[model samples]
Target: MTIAEDRAVELQEQIRLPRSMRLRLTRNGLTLVPITQAHWTTQRRIASQIEERLPGWTAVGEFSVIPPREGYSPEPDVSAVPSDQVLPDASKFQEDLLRFVVEVVSPESEERDYSTKSDHYALRGIEAYLVVNVLTARWTLLTRPQGGTYRHAVTGDFGEKIEIPVEDQTLVLDSSQFMRV
Candidate 1:
């Protein structure tokens, strides 16, 4: 087999999802964003912040974060996956996957999530990468394929509303109420 074909075959084997793991995915492939205790605190804070600042959005999902290493794609907060399609095994991308990976932006985890983790997601073509920039009390949304790297696509403050287009329905951030203003 040629080098590329050999690699693709090898990659397929490694991408299988683990039996021990419990995962949820969007129809596209996968999506997870775990909400932990700390994430709860921060997420609550963020949610309230958004609700107070904006009036129309809904604080639907919020996550407490944990540190994530390179090549990991955390589960999306919620994946709108269809029942018919099977989820691609994560083993192939474990080196590049996290089941809803959320990183606490504490000083301790700064390097891992912002620089290291971000770089890792870009390499794997992860569908979503959200940097809950806790410091500035803001959230950043990064998406789309840009020069093969996940560049800083957009930034929103705690008060702003983020409208995510899903089917005919609209998913608004509803974070305006969370803002202190």
Candidate 2:
């Protein structure tokens, strides 16, 4: 294999997901930005912070998140994959294995993150979904997935502590540090 291809293979093995931030490997090199240029750093910071705080969980950015059922789209901003779950490969991960998803709303990605992805995650039984709008520095947490949608939706500004209930426990997110208004 060529050097670049060999490096991709090596990176694929070393990257353990959720902890890698917004980085993705392509044939060219590592990609740290794919969604919005303005908010990529902020997005990466938020995902990395979550991974650091919740060391036991897998917090990955820009991964394809799909339902266990067939024919589900797998494009999400950030996904919190439970570390205890096992997957066959990196190409795809079952929705049931994902405990939460975080999508930062940029001007270019507001509609998709707010409406489309929310519907998909809820339909697939994802326990929690967080929508962060860095420009406004606001956060919305969606939980209690039922009837093909999240029954509970809570919104708060930056610096506020948001409690995200997932599985049988609660994950508290403190956005005071990174989410600047």
Per lDDT, the best of the predicted structures is 2
lDDT of 2 by residue, 1-181 (tens): 5565556657865865453334544334554433454366666776676677665676665555543233334456666667666354675676777878787776645676788678888888888888888778888999888977999999998898877765666667777754442
Query: Could you give candidate 1's per-residue lDDT for residues 113-145 as a string of tens digits?
Result: 566556555655554466665555566666653
Model 1: residues >4 Å from true position, as ranges? 1-38, 44-104, 146-148, 164-170, 177-181
Clashing pairs in 2: 18-59, 18-60, 64-74, 65-74
Query: In candidate 1, where is summed lDDT lowest over 10 consecutive residues?
Result: 90-99
Model 1 TM: 0.44
lDDT of 2: 0.68
- Give the CA lDDT, 0 to 100, for residue 128 in model 2: 86
lDDT of 2 at 136: 84
